[model samples]
Every structure is written in C-alpha cells, then in structure tokens.
Target: MARIELSGIQKRWGKVVGVRDVDIEIADEEFVVFLGPSGCGKTTTMRMIAGLEEPTEGEVIMDGEVMNDIDARDRDVAMVFQGYALYPNMTIYENIRFPLRMREVPKGEQDALVRRAAEMTELTDYLDRKPSALSGGQRQRAALARAIVRQPQVFLMDEPLSNLDAKLRQAMRVQIKHIQRQLKVTTVYVTHDQIEAMTLADRIVIMEGGAIQQIGTPDDIYNDPANTFVAGFIGSPPMNLVEGAIDAGTFTAQGIEVTGLPAALSGNVVLGFRPEDCTVGGNTPHLKGSVFGVEPTGDLTYLTIKVGGQQIEVKADRAFRAELDTEITVTFDPARICLFDAKSGERLR
Candidate 1:
C-alpha cells in the first residue's frame, strides 16, 4: 500500500481552469472520495492522480516520491472506468487476465491470478462468458476484478457505478465498500453522487467550479457544511435556505419574525437549516407556513412548505402526507439553524 499526495494541484485547459491550487493527503490504505456536481473538476482531479491527465501545476507524490514524471503504467495504480469498458469479444477470464498478459506473465501464473480474481469476485461460474452475456452488476464486478487482480498500490475509480439501476447501485455501493476495506488499498474515487461519497469514504472532498470546497468525514460535511453551497449540496431534500434580514435579536422573513438567532448575525443574511431540524407540530412556532406538498417514502416523509414566498422542505419520520394546498404551522430550532452571509454565500457564526 502507498499513501498518495497532491500538492498545489491545478489543471487548466487553455483559459479554463479544471481545478485550482488544491492540496490533499491520502493516507496509505485509506479510501478518499472526491464529490461535486458535474463539471466541478472531481473527474479532472482523479484523472490527474491516475496519470491519465497531466496537471497544469502541482505535484503527485506517492510514498515520498514525486510521481509527475512517471508513466501511467509505472504509477502502481489501477483504474476502473465509469463505463465498465470491458472488451466485448473477450470472455470474463480473458478480460481479467488481460493486464497480466500485457506484462507477459507465464501461462501458469496467469491462470492462477485470473482464477484467484474470479473467485474473489464470485465470477468463476461465468469465466467463459463474454461481456455481452453478463448482467450489469456482473460486468461491474468484472471491471473491479480486473483492477484488483493487479494488486496496485492505489485504486482510482471514476464514477464506476453511475450507470447501474437504483437497486443495483445501492448493492454495489456496499459491495465496493466491503471489497475496499478487505483489500486495504489506498483509493481515490470521484463521483457526483453524494450518497456514494458519504457511504464509502474515509473522508470526502467536496468541490465546485474547479476548486476544493471542503474535505472532511461524512458526518462533518453533513452536520457542518463550510458554506451555503455545501449546505445545499450535501443533504437529501437539501438544507433549507431562506433569504431574510436579522433585526435586533430576531430574523424577519416576509412579515413574519423568527427569534433567537446567534448574536453576531445582523443585516442581510441567509438562515439555513436541515429539514430534520424543523418540527411539524410545535407549541411555540418560529414561522407559520402552508404545506405545498408531501412525499412519503414509507420510512420518512418530506414536506414542502411555502414560507415567505419560498418553499422549504422538511424531513419527518411520521407519515404526514398532507394535501398540497393545506396551511401548516412550522417552527425552526435556532441553535440548529446555520447563518450565512447573503451577499457572499459564506457561512457566519
């Protein structure tokens, strides 16, 4: 295993910056995920580390050695592409053995290696079948097996499960996590799916517009986002952001008043809170609003309430699928509310 480090990393295409002045240290045998929306440079950063893309600036260091000058094949890393990219004509055995064959391993060793990989991935029963004969999940496993067979020091995966169905994707997430933990290889994964990042990473790197936004564990990014963008980006149904001004000790939205804001906040600011932080039935309410819609998914209910001309989503455990046009009373817990500068979208105390 090897620790990977990227220092002052920047990538540019002509005048467009794909990533800027980023520094990250990934410990040996740790799984790190790069997460963001599309075109945010998560993929770019992963590719640079994989030796597929040369960074415009910065260094890729591994195990105390600078890796910028090394060839892709010499980097001691394996990559699983987003599309699976299996050779259509090759059988599962052939595909998994391709890398070993490229390096001209003896036939007996290649057979041993391929057998071991197939056994680990549970693809031994279908070793003779080509890619066209395998299910999507099976194909994905084949791709992973190919990477695992190499025993690389680092594993780089670029949205490897993005194409699977919902159920399959969920299953694969657990499978991949289990495999990574068992192998203990340092891994760098890039994906736009927040759930995947949160579920798999030892730590997450949140990025946007070619820049790193925040890097922390799943709980850290979920409970304490660095800014408004991260606050909105990290959660399901997202954190509610209301445009309002703080006056005296209360926050005023439309004509309604919300009390108990932290003392330092004043003037134009945005109040942010997760849906779970708001309560549906409360005695002393912070704001009164109408329930615009309710989505019940058996285990949880999401209510979208109209507050001050904006819709705020609230997550609750009880099934409260109230009608769309119904008026609902809501309350915000001041201590749970996050404050951000309205103009800059920066979080405030």
Candidate 2:
C-alpha cells in the first residue's frame, strides 16, 4: 500500500541546486537504490522523501497523498543511517525497544516484537550487550532491529553498510535484501557503490550533478546503457571507448579498424565495448596493441593494452601469462559494440 512517487522534485539552497527535476515511482515493496558518486544529490533526494529536507518544487506523494508538508515522524518512515546510532549506554534489546516505546505500542506486545526483530537480524544472542560490547556488524544489526521494531511503511537506508569491512558489507547486503523481502516494506537505499546497487536493487536510479542519468534494472543498465556516462560507469573495469569515424559501415580510428557496423551511421563517433566481450589472439582482430600490464586476481586476469595511445582493459583467463610489451590482438563481436555521438556522448541506437 506504500507506493511512493516523487514528482518533479527539486531541492535548492539559494543559488545552489542540490537536486533537479527528479521524478520516480516506487512500487509497494519495491527495493529502489539511488546510486552515484559523492555530491551527486542521491542523499538529498532521500532526505526530501523523509521530510527531513523540504523541496523547493514538486511533490512527495505516498499512497496517492501529498506528503511534502507532513512531519518526518508522522510519515511512518524508518531511517537507518551510516553511523549505527545505537545508544552507548543502552543494551541491544533496550535500543531495539526504544522505537516501540516512543510509538507507545502496547507495552505488553513490545517484548515479543523486539525479540522477533532480534531473531530476524540474528542478534538474539547479543540482546543483553551494550553497543560498546558489540562488533561493527552486530551494532549495525541492532540499528536495523530498531527500525524493524517500528514496522514503518517505508525504509530509508543511507549507506548503511559503508562503515563495515568488505566481507561484512557483503554479508550485510544479503541480510538487508532478505529482511526487506521478509517485511515487504518499500525500501529506498542510497549508496555510491555500484556493486551494492547491482546486488540489492530491483531497479537502480543513477544520478550525477543533481540529475538522474538513468533508471533501470541492473541487467538493463549493464547490457544496454542509455548514454556514455552510463556505459562508462556501470561496469567493473568499464567499457572501452575509442574515438573514431564511421564511413560507409567501416569504423576507423588510430591503429584500429572495425567494419560491418550498421549502415545508418556516418562521421565521427565513439565506439564502446566491454572488456570481457573482447578476446585475445582472434583470427580477425578488431584491435591490435602491446600488453602494458597484466593483473591476476586469483579468479581472473586483467590485461591492459595500449592501442593508439589509448588504454583498453581486457579480462582474460586466470592462467593467462604474457610478458610486458608483448604484441596482442583482440577481437569482439561487432553486434556487441555500442556507438555514441563524439560531441554529446549520447548513444546512437
């Protein structure tokens, strides 16, 4: 029943704009992630939805009602911040129970609700310990338990896993996704980490410089990006982009030539392809270069090559072995390539 919609939302501080014309419809129980680099206004948008910050334009609608004027506490939204925010003096159980006490949910039912939340977060055994006695992961679980105790209509998590170590962050990502599914609460999570957005979201909203670049499922964003910014930002090692010209279906750049492209395009263009999509030592190589470096990460080897003074990264088998400065030939499917306007950076078909 909690369907949140932000219509033409804009946030401004005098001459500075924090967010501009953001419009998104989040379905009930949907997990939507706001993803971008720092200072991109992802957090400001979430704050507006939470009623912590007022928008200069547009409306915040929930269940078909305007919520821009509503107080934060009355919005029935639970926020878990980057900082665990657990009270130092309170035991984990008491911290989880604080939200229930504030809402004045019948004291008779508070214990059961707290216990249920604790069990769901796997913090049942640490109930009696204070925040100081818990590990970083456990403290975060305590914060989550507090939010769950309220049974809020929406969950706003702002970089909740940023403070944890890498391994713990991965574990918490699984737990958060599981808990969201279990509760069926419409959730909006904010993070700069693409891996987190790709793993946890049903849909991701990519933002930059107070504007949304694109919004789609992870697969859609990765496989068919809307623009060059998206093509470059969405993938690990990113897509290789080379400036070139297309003439009569032949794409030609310095030290590289690709043919059989769609006949509709002509003139200067930027060609893009994923690192993993390109192969080494193919019969008909699309690109030729010398191996500048090779990085092996146990599971895969990343090879960096210099092509016409531009660096292109390629993902190779983990056992791949090559000496520096060795000549290499790389080939990729022509159909897998992407084209963009060199000037505007907009995708061409």
Candidate 3:
C-alpha cells in the first residue's frame, strides 16, 4: 500500500537548481521510472525521495504521510545502487541476512526469510560464497536479494543494470521486472536508458534541464511526445527534426516542404516524424533525397537520406539497400508527423 506522491518537488544548490517543480503520483504497487540523460536530475529526484537529499520545496509523501523530515533508514524503503555495494567481507548469506539481523528478527525466522530471498534470486547455491567469488550479475542479484529481505514498503533502484554488459543487462531487466511484479511493492527505478524505461515502466517521467518534460505510459511517450525534446530523445534513431516555417498551409525548410497543416500555422516551426513512420516509397506524400548513410540492423535497414539539406532517417525493410549518394524517394505518413513551435519547442498540435 505504498502509494507515493512527489508534490511540487524542487531541489536547489544555492542558485543552481537540480530539479524544478516536479510532481508525480505513483499508484500503489505500480512501477514508475525516472528517465533522462546525464545531469538531468533523475538521480537527484531519486535521492530526494530516498531522504539522502533534502528538497528545497514540496513534499515526499508515502501512503499519505509526509516524509520530508523522515530519515532515509526510517522511511522503510530499500535501495539498490548501481555499484552493487555488497559487503566483500561477508558471505552472500550473511549479506542478505544483514538487514533482518539489524532489525533483530527472531533467529528462527531469519533462516526462512534469508533462504527465501536467496532462492527467489537464484542464489541459494552461492550463499556461502563471498562477494568477490561471484560474477557481476551474481553480485547485482545479491544486492537485489539483500533488498528483498528488507520487505520494505518502497523499492528504489538507481541504474541497477548499468553495471552489467548488454546481455547481462537484458537478463537483469527481466529478473528485476519479475521480482517487482511478484513482490508488488511500489517501485521507483531511475535510469537514463530509454529502452529500460520503455520496457519496464508502467509510467515514465521524462526529465530535462532540471524540469520534467512529460509523464505517461511507454506508448504515450513514444506515440505522442509532448515537445521536440521528448520526440528527439525517446526513440532509437530518435525523431527527425527539421527547422522550418509554415506559411499559410504550407511548411518549407531547407530540404523539405509539407502542406495540409492544421489551422493557419504560420511563423517558425519544427517538423518531427519517426524513422519508422516514413516509408521508402509507394505513398502519396513523398519527398525525394539522396542516400547519405545506410545502416543494416539485420532485422531492419535504416537509411539516412539527405532530404534537401536536412538528414532524414527512414526505416526500411531488411531487404532494402541503397548506395551512398544514390537518389532516393521517401514518403512520410502525414498522420504521424508532429509539428512544434520552433521558438518554444512545444508541440504545436
């Protein structure tokens, strides 16, 4: 029943603001992720939630109680850090059981609890091994196991998979999601990886420049970005943005032109569309360009076309191929295109 709410949260270091007016309501047992690039205040927001850093304004409420003054240890939250922060001197069993031991759970009860968490993490066999004896993934699992033993009301994980290799990271993501679902404790995960945010979050809080840009489910964030920054940051190849101006119903840029705009959108504007939304050809609305770069991902081929002076990326089928400097024609789905105010970066529609 750990429903968390961050109300008008802001953090500052004198004149340097770390986070600004961020607000989020996390439903009980829901998984939420704070996602952004480096120095974007994701971790700072998490730290404030954990009570490690004080918010210059607003409240950190859990289950309707304001936790602004509550010490971190007293907040009944478990945190898993990126570093794994395991006790090298202690055996896996001892490390996992440390929290229970600290809280003085009965000796008879400790064994079952410790063994259960270890078994849940698939570390039952390695309980006797010390931290150094385990691999990186195992160590991370050990850290997670330790958190599990706490049975805390909230779970705060800060880039728990960043330390692992790509394969291991994927595995850990599955493991983490599985554990979170099974436990059903309110969880907050912080990471810069958009894929992690997309695949793991029930709702994502996207931040930039110390302020929240948008918050929504993965599909919402992907399909309906709030602004140019979000559209540019959320995708694999990201959304292609070209600075242009809409005169009457027509949009004109260095290398692209689009008409049929909603209303009489005039003045400076930016156009955005996903690589996947644009096709190689065979559509009504088409733009011609030259192939500047082609990337084959085995599953799909990505073609970078120099549309006018702007480089527009178009996702093509795996069979698609084009040589550099070859003339190409790409069609954009007008329904999928986004328009933004060029000066403000806010979505126009």
Candidate 4:
C-alpha cells in the first residue's frame, strides 16, 4: 500500500484551466472520492493522479517519490474507466489474466489469481464467456477483476458505474465497496453522484470550477459544509439560503424578521438552515410565510414555504399532513443556523 499526495497540482489546456492549485493527501489504503458537478474538474483531477494527464504545475507523489514524467503504464496504478473497456474477443478469464500475462507471471500463478478474482466478483461461472456474452454488470466486474489481479498500489476509477442501469448501479456500488474492503487497495474514485460519494468514500473531495472547494468525511461535508457553495451542492433537496440583513440583534430578510440573534453578529449576511432544521408553528414563529408547495418523497416530505418573500424548504416527517397554500408560522433553532458573508459566500460562524 502507498500513500498518495498531490501538492499544488494544476492542469490546463491552452487558455482553459481544467484544474488549479489542488492539494490533497490520501493515506495508504484509504478510499478517497473526487466529487463535483459535470465539467467541474473531477475527472481531470483523477486522470492527473493516474498519470493519464500530466500536471501543468506541482507534483504527484507516491511513497515519497515524485511521479512527474512517469508514464501511465509505469505508474504502478490500475484504472477502471467508465466504459468498462474490456477486450471484445477475450474470454472473462483471459481478460482478468491479461495484466498478469503482460508482466509474464507463471501460468499456474495466473490461473490461481484469475480464479480468485472471478470468485470474489462472482464471475467464476462466466470465465469462458467473451465480453459480448456477458451482462453489463458482469462486464463491469471483469473490468474490476482485471484491475484487482494487478495488485497495484492504487486503484483509479472514473465513474465506472455511470453506464449501468439504476438498480445495477446500486448493486454494483455495494459490491464494489465490498471488493475494496477485501482488497484494501488505496483508491481514488471520481463521480458526479453525491450518493455514490457519500456511500463509497472514506473521505470526499468536493470541487468546483478548477479548484478544491472542501475535503471532509461524508458527515462533515453533509452536516457542516464550509460555505454556501458546498452546502448547496452536497444535499439532495439542498439547503435553503435566504439573503438577509443582520442588525440590532435581529435578522431581517424578505421583509420577515428573526429576533434574538446573537448580538455579536451584524451587517449583510446569508442565513442557511437545512430542511430538517426548520420546524412548523409553535409559541413563536421567527418568520411567517405561506406554504408554496409540498414534495413527498415517500419516507419524508419537504414543505416549501415563502417567508418574507423568500422561499425556504423545510423537512416534515412523513406522518405530518400539511397542505399547500396554507399560511404557517415557523421557527428555527438558533444553533442550527449557518451564517455566511453575503458578498463572499464564506461561512461567518
């Protein structure tokens, strides 16, 4: 196993900067995921680490050795592309054994290795079948098995499940995590899907246009995002951000007022609270609003309320039966609120 470090890494194409000044340290045997929206530099960053793309600046280090000018084939890394990329004519056994053969492993050792990988990936029964005969999931497993047989220091995967059907993707996610646990290979996975990142990563690197936005454990990114961009990007329904002013121990936004704010905070601020943090009417509503809509996702519902002309979404337990077009008073726990600078979008407290 090897720890991977990227320091001040950057990539550019002519005048277009693909990734800029990114620094990340991935511990040995850790599964780190690069997550972001499409074209947000996730794939480019993964490729740079895999040596598929050279950095325009900085370094890629493994086990204290700089990887600059190293070819992808000599990087001692195994990669699974999004397309599966299996050889069309090779049998499953041949596909899995191809890497070992390339390095001239003895025939007996290659057989054992291929068999073990197939069994682990549940591809033992399809060993003789060509890629064309295998199902999409099976083909994907073959790609994984190929990577596994190499026993490389790190595994780089670029949205490998993007081509699979929804149910298959879910199943493969679980299977892949299981395989990673058994192998314990340091892995760098890239995907736009937050659910995939949340479920598969030991830590997540959230990125935006050409730069690292935040890097944290799943819970840290989910529950305590560093800024408005991260908070708004990582959640499903997303956090509700209201443009407000802070003064005289109160927050005024969209004409609605929230009282009892800490006296230390003042000036233009953006207030953020998750849907689950806002509660329906009680003794006092920090703000008043009309219910704009109800979105039921079976297990829970989100109520979109218009407070002081600003729209906010609040989570409701599935058991609650609130109707749309109803005016409701609501309150938020002061501790749950996140304040951001209105101009910079940086978290204030």
Give TM per candidate.
0.96, 0.97, 0.97, 0.95
Per-model CA lDDT versus the true structure:
0.89, 0.93, 0.92, 0.89
Clashing pairs in 2: none
Compared with the true structure, the alpha-carbon lDDT of candidate 3 equals 0.92
How well does candidate 3 match the true structure in TM-score terms? 0.97
Return whichever of 1 and 3 wins on lDDT: 3
- What is the per-residue lDDT of model 4 for residues 1-349, given as tens digits with 9 covering 90 to 100? 8899999999999999999999999999999999999999999988988898999999999999999889888888999989999998889899999999887889879899999989888999999999999889999999999999878999999999999999999999999899898889999999999999999999999999989989999999988888899989887778888888999878888735777777888999988888888788878777688888887789988788876667888888776666777878778887878888899888886
How far off is model 3, as Cα RMSD? 1.2
Clashes of each: 0, 0, 1, 0
TM-score of 1: 0.96
Local accuracy of candidate 3 as per-residue lDDT tens digits, 1-349: 4999999999999999999999999999999999999899999999999999999999999999999999997888988998999998999999999989888889999999999999999999999999999999999999999999979899999999998999999999999999999999899999999999999999999999999999999999999999998999999899999998888888877657777887678899998989999888665545778899989999999898987767888889999988899887777888998999998899987
Clashing pairs in 3: 255-308
The parts of candidate 4 lying over 4 Å away from their true place are none
Which model is ahead, 1 or 3, in terms of TM-score? 3
lDDT string, candidate 2, 56-139, tens digits: 999999999999999997898998989989989999999999989988999999999999999999999999999999999999
Any residue pairs clashing in model 4, and if so which? none
Residue 325 displacement (Å), model 1: 2.8
Over 110-213, each residue of candidate 1 has an lDDT whose tens digit, in order, gives 88889888888889999999999999999999999999987889999999999899999998899889889988999999999999999999999999999999
Better candidate by lDDT, 2 or 4 = 2
Alpha carbon deviation, residue 310, candidate 3 (Å):
2.5
